[model samples]
Target: MRRRLPAVLALPVAASVLALAAGPAAAQVETTPVPAPGNPGAPPASAPASPQPLGHAVGDAGTGLAVIRVLPNSTPTKAILPGAADKLPKQAAVELGFGLASAQANSEAYLAYEKSIAQASPGGIAVQGSSPQAPGSLAQTAPPNNEAPLTGGINPPSTPLDTLVKVGALNGSVSANWSDALGPCVDTISDASTSIASISALNAIPTLPGGKDLTGAFDAPNLDEAADNAVVEQLKNLAGPLSTLGGILGGQGSAGGGSVLSLPNTLSARSVVKLVDIPGSPNKAVQSTSTLQVAALKLLAGTPFEISINVVSQPTLQVTSTGDAATSAVQYTAPVLEVTQGGKSLGRLDAANPKLDIPISLPLPGADDLPGLGDLGKLPIVGNLLGDGSPLRDALSKDLQKLDLGVLRLAVAGLNQTGAAATQPFKGYQLGATARMVDLQVLPTEALGLPNLPSALAQVSLGEQVARAYAPEGGVVCGTASAPQAPPAPAPQGSATPQLAYTNAAYHSVPLFWTGTAMLLFGVVLVAALPTRRRKTTD
Candidate 1:
């Protein structure tokens, strides 16, 4: 029961981890959630203008941090035999495959450029195992350059950008993005922000004891983030007579009036543990224990010893001001551990009930005597010779005392226990952590009084992932004088000079209709008097 305290205490630790992993903060330092996107308040447009510029950019454009953690070979296995120094496999070949990085982009105009190359590098251990095997189970040959420069402004990736690598017993990708986390202050109207990270380990040797030889036995832990964006627009006011005349001339208002656009980003993230598929529990973490089977000795005859766990961590940030946010709280789900024996259940342990103690009786029946000694005390002649007064009967009985055959003990911590990072923007420093997801121990065959049992069937420890993420803090400044302003509104039509219609030669112009009538009459008279015999001959 005393061994269960760690399981009971995993709740609070898990809670903090979830809080750290919850998406980007909604607001940053000195910043409030802007009215949903383009909806600036009516007061900002009509209210008296402040002598000061809209907002000034302040502080450094904070740094970006990322990491992938795997325990070292020196770490002891979950289960240790009485005198054996079993250690994890050496991981000399595992190189930092673009999983670690630190980068910065200045929000100020003079320093407006970006810097990703100088900081990006391969970092942190990438695999967890405790076998004496040399060179470890994972290895990478000719790792590619881990750095990739950014285009489209100094914006960190708003979407996940990843570098992939694959080698013996290792395959996966690492990614991160902080698009607009530090917006350009060159203009006050363009605000955008988001910071997130993700990691996917698709294939690696299982961290569980006796898990190496089991075909298809592996662990995959993944982290992912999703972001929501809102766009905002700021427009300059159009007033005064000149502005009205421009409207009349079909021209946009004064030469420099227009709207500024901004996108404020929000995010949500989830940490996922994808391992063996557990029965009746979809998406939960699981490990297969097939390598510990000893069919000849009837030890763990249960062909498939499956251990399942439930753990999830989500971290959330609450923005306090522009370009600044901090982890506020976390959502925690109690962790649970369940074990299945040869198709049958041994028992389970969870936050609510943190105790799991079960005993397995020896498979051999009618074997009351020690394996090396016969039932000498029970023989009629021997019993008489080694009477109650003698030490032979008493000693023999004590040596044959029954021993528990095998037992299972398990402890599971929330995903938070796996790893965490703490940020100190003021100090420009970050701290990292590494922890275990699960701890499991099963009685070895030697514990069953079988000293000559093969080491394969003597697993002592089984556990899962450890991880971390980190970045130095930064500040943001909004540009004032150099910031671009909105363009003028277009001029309205139909205001041309009205006098042009009234200024015509004032009624002095001839009435063409009367003149045409007089001409027609004259022509008729001439034709009647001088040309009377025009068509008579033809008739």
Candidate 2:
């Protein structure tokens, strides 16, 4: 009986062992960050500012952005802000920062002036992580803080950063106010700024019943419990007859080991939030955008139950204001949900609804269908045990629980407040962009001929983002009540035409009129006298 145990129990032992090894290991988030797209810290490309006189330019704009990506079982790497001009200097367990009225000099004059008054004061903060729990990869920051040095041409920009942990999330972000007073009179001011952030695997899958965080993801313990609940005992009773069949199959009866879900090869979220205070004009404009792309969800590693899924989402907003009249436009998009069963497709689900319910069925082998157990049904005790309605089949059905396919959720929203001095009565309008994707309750399980197997072996999520951006009212402006005007140039010497000198004389029209009247009177008298003589002779 002892020698027969190993061979008889091989199938159950192997299945249970495979379930135990299906869980994913704790690993650092890996990322391949790319350069941010579109105009960073500037207005949208679709809309360009209209032409205006040089010194009359005036505008206020801002944006905020962030990014986080988690990759397991790979080398720890740094996450970069897509459009930032600089990179992180070094790796630290933990980094924290804070700042105040820090600004960069963007104009030639301001840059030169900054050199004269600029003293390196402690305007920013930095702290490194040293503790074991601190992975030295975590980072955090507040307003005015920067992950890298300023480009030295704008108001000190605010750039904050954070790291990904077990929950699989991190953030990279930047924002700033840039204003330059240039030209000889320093009357010209140009301003522009923006902000954004990105995240990965937004959150964790919820823990479910049966002490299984992920359904069939790591089922070693669950399988053991099921075995203890009479599964192994029932299998042993029938193993003696099926041993030959199990051997003929060459140990291929159990579902292959490993996770059920694949990692996101292309999970990413990007946002373009930028503002511009029109130079030489009271008009201001801003645009906000949020985009998310998730690679197909590939399931059922090393099995026929493998499948795939693709998700999509996007939101946008644009606004322009004349400081008294505001105008705006908005756009949004929804996604489609598709499910696949093994090599076959299950078609699409109702996208408007979030709940999902799908059933699975597989063909089972009959008593005579067993390769080595063809005549087993003809035996006495064994025939009864192997016949229809047997306890072994019941035990297998009772132990193989339903698979939890998990949920994928996406959300997006946009906000644009136009600046209107009359009704809105705000110096600066607020612009916001937000997008997020969440995956929860993922436990991939599928029924085989007997017990259950993981439906897929892949990573749960690709990446995530929480879009939050803003553009404040005022920036660097002159202290004067009204804008100063440029002085006129002096007249040149030795010009082509000489100027006429002023003369002290009576009004020309009055003098000429009186002289002409006196002459007329004298001439009339002489003509009358001479004409009288002539008229008398003619009469």
Candidate 3:
């Protein structure tokens, strides 16, 4: 009976499968091509073309990379120490690099010293070693022993003598360390002065006097007397200050009881002894030489010396104008003067002729005309000597004529190329020129009765003016252009736009129009894969 029932069930299942298989064959089918509408004969519109890739284009203008090279225009008036001038330019080139290296070394040395002291201290130990008691540990270990007197440690180590000697040598090398440090400092100072002087000489502009005869002051009868008095006063003032400085450096007296040598006075025996006793006096030898040089310069200009002025000929002042371009013009005027130094009235010397072409860039400031005037003003009675409209200004103005200078163009070429256009940039500039007087009347106003005053004033003023003028011009020429180049024309309308191609066969093909289908399929698959829990079996 059971076998008969199984046969009956199998028969029904087989019949149902056969019926389902035959049903699909009877379904409808259509395969013929469909006909097109009215525009079927028309040609397909041409596709848009892709844009061409343009290469990089560069514009020509100020490149923002400029080189400034300042050539020496004249031999330096101040004599440099032997080999010093030759080394100056080279030293400046490497100054910053050398300074950085020195600073790094100094820092390392300081750090090493600190580490050594820490290592030598009582409780300090190597990181790798097991430390004894860490002050408040619950373990309660025994304190570290005396460290066996550091047999090979830095503190009385096996190499103690050698280490100590090395340390001593390093300590004694303070002078060497200081020398290395000061070298860059001095180079900076010298370079700064040279650059300043150069710029001043280049940009000097001559200022004209108002109604006063620029040359009359030199011809005054009391010029010699005034110069002598000025020198004496300067010498006296210098003596007191120098004495104070010498005493301080020599460690002689805290209350100042030393005889300092005056500018005009010869070096005293006592001063020589005191100077010899000073530890670092040799470094200051140049200062003494400079002082003597200053005195010499002053003496040559007639201060502290009796000098008579002889008018060789009245100066001839000429002015001319030239068209700089079609719309702009520049005018140049020069005043030429010829005068003799001695009482005898001699013809103008040929040496002074060249200076006539140089123009006065600017009048000397009143403060610079009087020697020790700045210091004198601080004193009670001496302050009265430098009152306004004093002889110092008149004397200085008169001396200016002796320089025989007028304005002359300073042609700068190298500057235009390096500034903003070249690779190596110029940080600063320098200028120099040789100046001679036709009769010494073209000298600066300070020179007339002040002795060497004209040269000093010229040195300071010429450098200042020239530097200020050229620095800006050089900056403009070197700076980057104000505007950037325009971009190329927008890419032509494209046929096939470039895009990232992705393969999407295995993954449901996410067509441009079927993004929604892909998202729906992904959510359905995720939900169907989740496990459904069955009810717990109950006994």
TM-score for all models, in order of appearance: 0.28, 0.34, 0.17
Q: Compose the digit string of candidate 2's lDDT tens values, residues 254-327.
A: 21321234433433333333334556645333333344445455433233233455543332222332222233
lDDT of 3 at 112: 16
Candidate 1: list runs displaced more than 4 Å.
1-174, 178-327, 340-345, 355-402, 414-436, 443-539
lDDT of 1 at 147: 31
Global lDDT scores for all candidate models: 0.24, 0.27, 0.18
In terms of lDDT, which candidate is strongest? 2
Per-model RMSD to reference: 29.6, 25.2, 37.3
TM-score of 2: 0.34
- List clash counts for every candidate, in order: 50, 58, 49
Model 1 lDDT per residue over 444-519, tens place = 3232222233222111111221222222233222223343445589787778766545556645456666788799
2 or 3: which has the higher lDDT? 2
Rank by TM-score, highest first.
Answer: 2, 1, 3
lDDT of 3 by residue, 1-539 (tens): 01011222222212211111011110001111223445977766432242211111000000000011111112222224876655432110100000000000011111111100000110111111111211100010001111111111111122322200111000000001111212111211000000000000101111212111222223322446554444334323321221122111111221222111111211100000000011322211000000000110001121111122222322211111110112111111122323222332222323233332222222222333554344322111110012221333344444521121122212111111111211211222211111111111123333233222222111110100000000111111111223334568998786887786767565544464488878899999999999998999989
lDDT of 3: 0.18
lDDT value for model 1:
0.24
Ten-residue segment with the worst summed lDDT in candidate 1? Answer: 227-236
Q: Which candidate would rank higher by TM-score, 1 or 3? A: 1
For model 3, how many clashes? Answer: 49
